[model samples]
Target chain A: MSPADDPCIGDVSEGHILRAILARTPAAEHALLGPGDDAAVIAAPSGSVVVTTDTLVHGPDFRLAWSSAYDLGWKAAAVNLADVAAMGARPTALLVALAVPRDLRVSFVEGMADGLRDACAALAPGCAVVGGDLTVSSVLTIAVTAMGDLEGRRPVTRAGAEVGDVVAVAGELGQAAQGLAVLFGRFRDGDDPVPVDPAQLAAGERLALNAQLRPVPPIGLGPLAAIAGATAMMDVSDGLAIDAGRLAAASAVTIALESRALGADPARALAGGEDHALLATFPSDGPLPPGFRAIGVVQPPREDAPVTCDGIAADPAGWDPYRDWDATAG
Target chain B: MSPADDPCIGDVSEGHILRAILARTPAAEHALLGPGDDAAVIAAPSGSVVVTTDTLVHGPDFRLAWSSAYDLGWKAAAVNLADVAAMGARPTALLVALAVPRDLRVSFVEGMADGLRDACAALAPGCAVVGGDLTVSSVLTIAVTAMGDLEGRRPVTRAGAEVGDVVAVAGELGQAAQGLAVLFGRFRDGDDPVPVDPAQLAAGERLALNAQLRPVPPIGLGPLAAIAGATAMMDVSDGLAIDAGRLAAASAVTIALESRALGADPARALAGGEDHALLATFPSDGPLPPGFRAIGVVQPPREDAPVTCDGIAADPAGWDPYRDWDATAG
Candidate 1:
């Protein structure tokens, strides 16, 4: 049965809510131990674990009125899993802490669980929601901690990009930002005119909107890139320009982007955010890895200009969680 | 300088906030890869890892007016660490997801970092806050995921206790509930007449307040209990009656407690919450582990009575995050 047909989260006890979640999201293969225990045991094949955390708050992160519970859950999983993937690790387990208002629906929790499971099954096989905490709060928050296994591979960090490296990307970019733009334009001034169905839209429009609501980062490509000898890597949660600037700063080098290679609007690719694409740098002579295409080149650091596009400096107008961009835009 | 002397979280950029946190909490030994990267890599010496998560929301879980940021941080670490210890693992790493309002003081964030560091240094040496995500939210929330190493020991699960096992607790109880009582009585409504200082309260009173704020669970004792042949174990975040009931139910047995052995008021021990003690059962033939005193005995499953004290059935009155017991009490 659909979560909407179930009891409201507030109407049922926390125990019921947990049972619902567990019933839906069966334990994946890698989980030596799953939920119902004080803690979970997960295999660490390389005798190491890669960990990253992300949080999605209701207001600043997503508009509750626009995104479904399933979307929230998918985005939460996508963003966190992408972080683990960026480190050249195989996504393994997730520990979630979900807090919602008492008035929320039980179906929302179930949809969320389904989203987490669906995302894991699709993006990173064997990744499981091993354990989590649920609490009550005025603001809904989905906090996720993702752990990964390196399997004896070296971690690809942003600091290893050397001058003379080829800069590349492994997934779509500028789509989520374009989707958010459409969402804000469509639902402006609290006037919601029956949100447009993603299916009803054109291919590009559907991709954009879905990107905004449920991002699917190239998770599997991370370890592949590392094995293929990529030196520096990061998930582009921020705009490409901003994230690339971070890589440049970390590596003490300059990234020179070729605008045409991105396929999407060059400016949007540079400035729009949340597509969660994988950006990496490889040795100049090494072939670009599968699922990745060269988009730029790494050059000696320039004190004032860390990242540039076609020889011009690129602005770092990435998403900042603290900014009230919605208020101004709305 | 103290956190109180710092800037506000809202005024600075995310970069500045990250810098401050990284500066304050340096990586520990196990972090093969630490902060400044997309994710952290930690050594899992046991080839497997124990993982757990917990969330502390602003209004429901704590009152900022009463509990300092330092207290919140320490408690977050303790509660999650305790879960790992309950599984007979040595706490190794922590990944924090912090969400707070824009108006929060930067000093608060700093104090929280310090608190996390202090708790690790004091309670579980070598454990570190290797990575975290900080975001802006309407309500303050601290979500922590703790990872532990079992060192090749068998995980003491809650399902192994036999009918003839002896039940024991590894830490204090009822103190946190008592502290909450004092806080509620002292600062009810918006009156806020400067909460009682923990130092000024009597030793017993101080213990209660401190327990409510910065719970230092006996993590070290958990491993000892497991090594000494604990059959079943769990961290007592809920009151003894409730958590023990859960243990009993999971093990398909009943726990009969001796009121005199608990050294606290029977009702308080059974109903109070947030004490975060270790509740374990061992074979009756084996001696109680060091630092544990027998408080109960396991018995065959009783259809009506799941947990009893002094031969009288004890109701499970554990803290329910979904329930607003505070508003009713106030």
Candidate 2:
């Protein structure tokens, strides 16, 4: 569509924009009552629902020049889904709350809805957008709340790991962080962010870029791990070293990593974040689940550090919005 | 606390801020798993859970000069709870997503948590904040998702109203809008919003200001309406004329309102919004619910407007953020 065909969202009515978005949203499998009501009713066959909320803001969370509306929507939904999955639950529905700039086009909103639908279809089937709220703001923000069902199984928490448990990970670790490196190192024009040039990216870098833009965490493996007698589980969103340290602290144990198991770039794997890989602990007596690969072992709590690499204390370096985000640098 | 004690959130770690806020948050009655986890698990005893989301942005939604941190938090939770209540369900849990500026005070966040706790305690007694996400943003925003339980009763939707139903409301009308008017008319200094002066207000204005700042919608009366055999229900976030018209269009009926039934200021009652009053339609044969009073009667679909007052067409005027919000106007 041409610019004439794309009207500014501010020029239209809220209902008009909502209708366009609602038309793109798919029917949720677990919805007893869907949109166009005061609220939507989602089925909870397991007698309880696992829910989590995550937000993507314009500046600190993402840059518009680097991330498209589709990528933003997908990342927002994927991150929240990973949280629910980390709790050993099957995602059922998503409720999106969008605060968009009025100057943006209506098409951007439509693209976001499509992205939300496609992400759910690809990452966690049977889950879809059941309800949402839209309002005007100077900053473009997407906040998503995801709900899931446990399917008669108990939720796996980070505090469940025992000393003898084997620590394992599923999905990529350093790829998303590598993508961030690519964006910062090659795709910037002075202090401002510029769009990525696909031609400049190598095959590996392209994969890394995709990992950063739209992470497909091991969603199905969460329930699998729970069923396989896994003791602890959490998604690796803020690097393996930092997240592993969190798990260790929560469980009151120390985790010692095997450097060779973390792929060729062990340092990158330990420090890279936003890949949304599943980090879980299983009993040492049983075989690890099909998709998960053992990378560490839970040990008695040590005074030095919560996590260690090759018998040495590892740096707990990861993204912390409060300490790391600098609006001027972006 | 002294000025040195109340440091900016930018100086503190995310964990420090979270711990401060969590210390003030009350334990959710329906929570199987609460905060400090990847996700929260809320009990859905009736086999299904009702969910809805609403957002409050800094500029269009509120101004820091006028509303306190506590007011913002209370309003955010109260608004979302009203939506779930309108679905004829008892609220169970709330998941908050806060995108705040780094320069704000940690004490402000703790106050917000207290507001969320107090709002839930006052409006929906059993409900409390179960989980939340906090991120940095240029524009402060609060996005809340509320979940509720039906307790075996089917939802009372706006589409279920019949021609013979009696239109009723269970809360004050025009009060919030009156409060807004007070702020705009008296508390502003040119383009910027000035702090509200309580010493300059009368008793009625104080009440109106409180209504706008922290609305106490009749949350309990929602389930009561369902048990009282109400055919249709909705919360009047927009003005009665506009929201009633929406309900009429959804139910394929016309609403004939009695102006005499409305209190003294009928025009303000018809046009003002944000009161979040529970509007319902009950069978003409049954007595009205305890908190509700008759306002109008449902009629067959007409060629004219969806809503009428004193047998004449009533104008549908309400807040539409896209068209109504002007950044320069404050």
Candidate 3:
């Protein structure tokens, strides 16, 4: 297809798709300069900033057959924004670098752009696409950088959770893991990859699939929790249990979770990751804000275990990159 | 090495590496909270910020055989920092995403950290290595995102130069290209892979090789030129002839260069890329700064060419990503 004409829905080169996506970007108010420059320029209020980056490689992290380019784009931005949000900072902008095979379709690239726009719109106010480098590679890879501003507040850190702090979470937990399970058909045994009836998958499963594909990180909640006197905060990219263990270790405290208080399927909530949910610690005496649910408490380190649930020591069972998941399942 | 020997280095496991990088990062003074929680919070100084990202792939960008891990680390930081500098902004912080084979040595990873330390020390003061994600991949790749502070200064854009402006440059030119040429052994044709004699390559050639291995960008010069009243500016990553053409087109003007003024082997100076030098434009009548040298004049569009050298039209030549150097050479 000619560049002007939309290539068949999933059939255009990445370069052509990128150009199309760039063409649709609206000029944000605080953006002095956006895409096309060597780097983007934004108005920095306090002369200080926070920056973070992440990369997603095909095969290891995702598969194109199951994921649309738009989903990949959105996920890339979401992951980086989650890091910035974990810093208790408000995201302001992003830079994206993509490597794709030359034979890839332009439509796929456009979908990726759409996904990026959707994610940025939800997470960052006045965020614009900036400079990027495009190249051909054996596998598709995406790299994203997110920038944020902390408006003169002392940054809360993982080390700040003292004994007696209440642990709370803003946003859902385990949705992404459930979603991935549905997507990969692991939730059902001997499921056909191309089923005779695709509708056999439940609607709720579809929602989970969407969650896995496009995680909506709790962006504003980070700065909000900070303002509300959260002692510490973090984005739950890994499973809640694993990430909570990290917070406890960093703060040199023991954390006890009332797993029963967590929403349905507590096991999923404990071990499922990629939720992008905000888990924060607030002082026991502090007022808890709306939407934040208390699920645990911080205490002085006890014998052996750093984290426990319902008065019993809980195994730190979650995804381990080095281990085989299938073997563990059996 | 045992994890106890380098507590600061944290666990060498991919997961542990992610935790360690995040642990030492303190929240920005303006940060409401830093990494550890669901999302980070930052106080937007003016409710805006500029962002950019780049990825360095092994083999295509650098070879482990020729460059030390530290050199690779430094170069990665320099490239991203240069992008921020090119926008006439001061870099404030960075986020790095890394992928490597699991079999890689811990010492090699330490070298990368050292390189990051050195690069940040030279370029951005107090810039934090805030957050990143790590995963296993077949090859080593680094993704870096750099954020900058505009500090209320009007950003110098490529599109702002006008006719009759004076074109000037700050920092060294062609050093990286010269270094690259020597590294590829183009200086000595048909040479064995291993040099017949270790001392055969001159010290100057070795210096050039080092330059390519670890480019030292003139980070301060960009902001300095901006403060000194530069109307337009950019970091010279591509060759001067090609990048100058980009600036001219953006400003809708023609640029003329004085070949004699370009000191020594003008062709190399004009065609070499990766200098990371800042090329800028100012009002012709304004006083130029101490380190900047006048290189050309901006003029109204002429029938001859967009960029000309010493009254003669010049071809726009430099690195083209799609074209192989070997094929072009033949």
Candidate 4:
């Protein structure tokens, strides 16, 4: 087939599409191995590799109506980057695979490219787009593989939290969750697609929407926490309460959150996820690192409750893939 | 959601599936860059990197009837590896992104992992699966990103062929086409799927099918050919005749094949692609590399022909993504 017949083709200006996409990504840094190299070369230091895979299918995870091609691209990259960061490693590079219907506009593909570039710039600077394959598909889908460098630190797995360490956060929380609520009409649906007031869009809500589309993972913070003598760490992709329970179960400990200490609305902040923030634990007396704030502490497990807030038992308040959230809501 | 409700959950056995998937993948040598490590590290020999991306959607490129989860995995890795090899580089590592329907067998996912492992075993030794994201989708799709080391060698691009160079190939051709014909019922239509008779299948045919499912690219051959003074080189994922035309057009040269010398049924070999074989050109008197066989030579461009065979103009015969092939009557 001619290039025109290749499903990913369209008439949108490639350069403009790319720029719009890149505008939202973070910057790069050293120790990034080869960010722009054919395949990035990160310093493994630990002699072992940690890997995972993720894909975003159109119509399900994202829609073309509220999100732009650039936004989609950024989100695709952000999710993968967040996964790497969650492993307590510094992300180094990425490999992207895209499938699109032949009728797609060329601008969309360029926008996707821009999103990838922007994400790499922010989270894993110098992270290069290596090699991928393209073909026509029934719908739009993106698959991304991110590479990271452990840099000689032991991987801070979910299975390592102890009975008595201070729990803390290193980035914004609940913002992306709120953003999702706004974008999907959890707040108000069937209205103007774009927000009417530019100011409302800019204040945190827009940033949250941006978070859902293009998450800026606390890339360096994971490793930095590990270096700072933090005992366990993970990126907050899932809501804090649910993910914290996971850490508790893995480490066979009880986690107690002092809800009042959490910024803003404690319940929303605790239940909301997709912040691309880092949640970590350290000795009760250890010094908290820069960009980190104390949120809670790990406690000895109770016979009936594995997670609690102060003296009260807590239940998971997060999104479930199979359950209908709107129906379950009061 | 419980793992069952998660869209990514499949019937595939987790450990065995991942192991089978890892088994097929080749290992990376400079460092451990595969699944088990916290993060993989690949050697980036070149200061500059070349990157590209592609994705495979189920039902369109492959059918569940002819392929297993393992086969899908291998095919995904093979396609990306072919691209890197085409760029005249040695593949270093890979990142895989997969999406599966929740009801899908977990074994299928594992099988896909097996296929990735298998492809790596054959073509990209020691390369690791660094990192990826997992999600649920309505359809099964695979995205692969491959990284390669250029090793200080100049990339052999499509734009480098010139007049007077002999065209040569390393690896088989047409077998994949024949296999496709057999698998898809182009050769013989029936009520039931064509049962492949093991005894009746030629070694080349078997090889071709294997190549289609898991193409073992001559990964280092591209750069090696360049080092051996070859003028241009590329992996033949498309038919030779079609790809040769591309080379000729890119370099502004004419290509002429000695049809009589090409053996019987050379058109089948020339027109069929998916071999993942390296095709290169060298000076007429230059010694052919050990694994390569001379096929044709470059010539001055004719007014009405970009390519010809036996002094007679020939029609393009490569496979097209959207067009049906009309095999010539024997």
Candidate 5:
């Protein structure tokens, strides 16, 4: 393809770029009013709307060479959807605010819009992009806010976990971190990132890469856990070790994990971030929800640490944006 | 103040920075569940929610030398709130997504939080910041999503205006643009922007600067106009000429404005951007809403242009981020 085939977004009008993106956006099921308006009206059936916002910025969040526009869009939507689901609500709509470099091609934005539509279709059936804002910037940033309906159920909050509750999880825990390791270890040339070559990846490595790029977190299990009388819930965005510790602190209980239940790589499972798996607690006597697997038990608060593995304190190390983001590496 | 006294955000944990901001954020009247949860649960008394998102980027949308952290936060909230107001809804909550450079001071972020709180208090009394996200980015960006309740009234969209409807506006027009002119015209060193000097400004220039920095749009008038039976409504972020043309196009009618009604500086009002005043249409027979004043009338569609001034075609020229942002100016 010739360079002229892909005109930069800077070369077009806002309406032209908007039309291209809107062409790819599917109709939202819960929207009473959609785009081309001052605001979108979304049906909040239970008289309450669940909302959360998450952002993916270049350098700290992703490297352009590694993440395609689709990957970036998918991850941005998935992450925010995970937050809404963690509150035991069904996602109804997404409002994306994109600030991108002017030099980027319009097709890149269309690819992102496609990814947003596909993610919503796959993860939450009725949810779709309802409205958005676009701005030009040197940094490529995707900030997505996902809204949801609780359908009359009480919201599941992290502070509700009771002592003696069963700690459970639904979705892969360490895969995303493994994918990050794969990229950092093999795909980088010196301090700069290089595009991934599928031929160089093993079967499991490819799976890991997909998990990192287009994570399919078990979003449905969130409402299922709530319906099954789960005591508390949260998305494990910053690994089990750190996130469980946070949950424990919020609930004023200690989370005791069994090392053997952590699967093949316990260390990575304990410290990995961005998996966005639902970490929840159900009453100890009740059977665990169908999609959820018990990994730990909630105990009375211990003075030593908020979380433990096989009765030993586990370090709650997780990705801290300010501390961990390496600007030079991106 | 010494730089040592104002620590960089990178020097602290995310929790530390969050606590500082959270301390300033007041509770929302409609928030069923606030911050600390995975997502905020906002009350939607009418069984539906009005949602909109708007972003302010460092280079294209604002310049740090000209806009203080407080000004940036206030303007970000004001713009998104106006969109909700334009929908004839009462804003209930705001979710902010902020991406800042690691080198920014924590105090700067705290000041932004203060501005967000004050804007909500002054503009929309019951509205407040309910949830937010923080991320690291090379370019500073503030993306805000505002949610509102329709209060059982039908949404007043831009497509509803009919021929003979009176075109009216609530809030100031072109003031923000005049403020921008003041900043660009007076507060620049070569190509780079410099801090605004109040001492050098005349009284009216100060008001213009305030309008640009902290816009106090007539937010309450939106629902009032809706109650008074507005046929169509939209915020005038772009100049009246461009935005009215959009409204006219949406409604398939021609908006004929009286230039005499457009204040002293009609040309500036027609071409300036970012004022965010509410532009609406009402039945010609009805008395104008208390806070709104008539500016024009709707007529049959015109082949030449959607908007006209004194029966002459008006150019729909306004700021285009991609075309107008100068990289070296900021």
Candidate 6:
């Protein structure tokens, strides 16, 4: 049945909805126990598990009018997997807590799961959607917690940067923020969230919109960077300036980024967020791994500031959805 | 600062609020990496991890007026921990995804964390609030995912019951549902979400309300049951009949309850939900574990139904919050 008729969550029972979604769950080779029980079991043979959670609300995280359910599923899985990668662990399984409005289409749920499975298959082959909880709510919210296998290595935390270390990144820089800006501009009146098929858009415009709707972080490089002797690492989620400031403060060092080294768009590299790229600090003498490029250097702590670009102070203005909507409509 | 006047979330920025909450996080012995990073590292010495998720919406799951931040935290932790326990695992860490209205008080978040900490401390020590995401939403929703260490034991899934197994419970039954009924009765108009100090109520009434607001499942018994050899098990979140029917159906057997054994009020014992007690099946020749009382016996599949009470058919009409709200008011 089409979601528009008798297939919307509100019209169907919870049991009916769950069974439909279960039929589409991707093969979970790493899962010891899948859904349909009190809890799911997964192997943690590494003796340690890296864990993290993120919730995307309807208004603050995404607009259904702009994002298809497939994109929502992709984005949600990508965001959480990025956290696992940031820990220098291979994401192995995810548990999702989804709350949806009754009027939500059954297709919405299936498309979301399809996105989750597709993302896992594409990004982390062994990672699976192990278990999840579904409930009714006024808004569609996805809260996902991801677990990763460290494979017996020390986690690369955000607190290990040392003075004289070289700072580097291993994924696209600032494209998400750029995409968000483009979408905002396109939906200027804020009245329209639906966009033309991205395939029909100009190349640059399409790239930006895709970045906003579907973020693909380079997941493989996190573990590689750790093995390559990276001292500290984190995903660049809330802008480089702010998150770098965090790593610097934690490591008690100052980070100095060279503008020329940050591609043609230095400001976006410094201030844009949601790239989900790995930002790391490696010993200056160590080698930068493949897909990684040096962006800055860690300096001994300066009492006045923890981050800088060249010799000037760089403002770390990250995207804050809370503040964004607090001020006005999207 | 008190949560009321100067601590509303909107008044304080997200960074400021996060730091304040971070300052109060308790020590987590099982956590290799705690909050303040991209992800937390949890000790999983066992080769396996037990995972589960539950989402509590503001209006559907709870009301802010009737429940305090502390109660919410306690209840949330208790619910998820129970799922781990049902699987015969020790809950090791929790990742909370809290979405709240901007106008909510920072104290609300702190209090919720405090409740989380206190619950972990009092109920399941070493299970820490390792990491979480805080975002803005129109409603306050808590979606928590709990990870558990199996300690190298085979999980007690719901499909292992054998014919002639004895059905037993490890904690309270029917109380939470009764408590919910009392609260709904007291708040007939539903105008007052907040209730007076429960201590002022008669013991019976107080017990009912407390069961509804804060459920303290018998956590230590799950592993003990596994050690004692429970063939099958599940937590009693849904009513006994509904959940037991699940076990019976899963195990491909009939679970017949003997009314005389389920204390007084057999209806409540059979139909009430949210008790968070461990219901399990053990070999009839084996001894029932401590804290568990026999209430039924597993029988070979019966043609009439999967579950029955006193040789008569039992209808499973457990709590369905989705349907309740679907028909009417907030």
iRMS (Å) per candidate: 2.4, 1.3, 5.0, 7.2, 1.1, 2.1
CAPRI class of candidate 6? medium
lDDT per residue for candidate 1 within A1-330, as digits (tens), equals 665577665577778888888898868677877899999999998899999999998767886767888999899999999999999999999988999877788888889998999999999999989989998877789999999999899899999998899999999888898888777666555643245656656788777989989999999999999899989999998899999999999999999999889785898888778989999999988688889999999999988789999898988877443256442111
Lowest-sum lDDT 10-residue window in model 2 chain B: B320-329
| Higher-scoring candidate on DockQ, 1 or 6 | 6
Taking the tens digit of each residue's C-alpha lDDT, what string does model 3 give over A57-95?
775666665667888989998888877676677777777
Worst 10 residues of 3 chain A by lDDT: A321-330
**Clashing pairs for predicted structure model 1, backbone only:** A8-A106, A9-A105, A9-A106
Candidate 4 per-residue C-alpha lDDT over A12-88 given as tens digits, one digit per residue, 9 for 90 to 100: 33234333333433333332322221223333344444444566776556666567778877877776676666666
Error of 3 at B191 (Å): 14
Q: What ranges in model 6 sit over 4 Å off? A: A1-6, A190-200, A319-322, A326-330, B1-5, B190-200, B326-330
The CA lDDT at A96 in model 5 is 92
lDDT to native, each model? 0.86, 0.90, 0.71, 0.65, 0.91, 0.85
lDDT of 5 by residue, A203-288 (tens): 99999999998999988888888899989999999899999988899999999999898999899899888899999999988899
What's the distance in Å from true for residue B209, model 3?
1.9
Instruction: State the lDDT of candidate 5 residue by residue for B6-110, as single tens digits.
Output: 888778878888889999998889999999889999999899999999999887888999889999989999999999999999999999999998999999999
**Off by more than 4 A, model 2:** A319-325, A328-330, B319-324, B328-330
Q: Which lDDT tens digits does candidate 1 get at residues B69-177? A: 8999899999999999999999999998999878788878988999999999998999999999998886888999999999899889999989989999988888888
Candidate 6: residue B22 lDDT (0-100): 76
Error of 2 at B146 (Å): 0.6
Poorest 10 consecutive residues of model 5 chain A by lDDT? A319-328
Off by over 4 Å in 5: A319-325, A328-330, B319-323
- Looking at candidate 1 chain B, the ten consecutive residues that score lowest on lDDT are B321-330
> Tens-digit lDDT track for model 4 on B1-330?
365643346444333444555565445564433454223444454543333344666655665656677788888887777766666667766766676665675556767777777777777776555544455565677777776666666666766777889888887777677677656653233433344556766777677677666666676566677678777776776787777776777678887887765556778777888777777888887798777788888888885777788877767767543232211110
Quote the lDDT for B228 in model 5: 98
lDDT (10s digit) by residue, model 6, range B153-267: 9999999999989999989989998888776666545444455556557889888888888888998899999999999999999889999999998999999998998778889
**In order, how many clashes per candidate?**
3, 0, 37, 65, 0, 2
Q: With candidate 4 superimposed using the best TM-score fit, by how many Å does residue B260's alpha carbon deviate from the native?
A: 4.5
What order do you get sorting by lDDT, best first?
Answer: 5, 2, 1, 6, 3, 4
Docking class of 4: acceptable
Top DockQ prediction, candidate number: 5
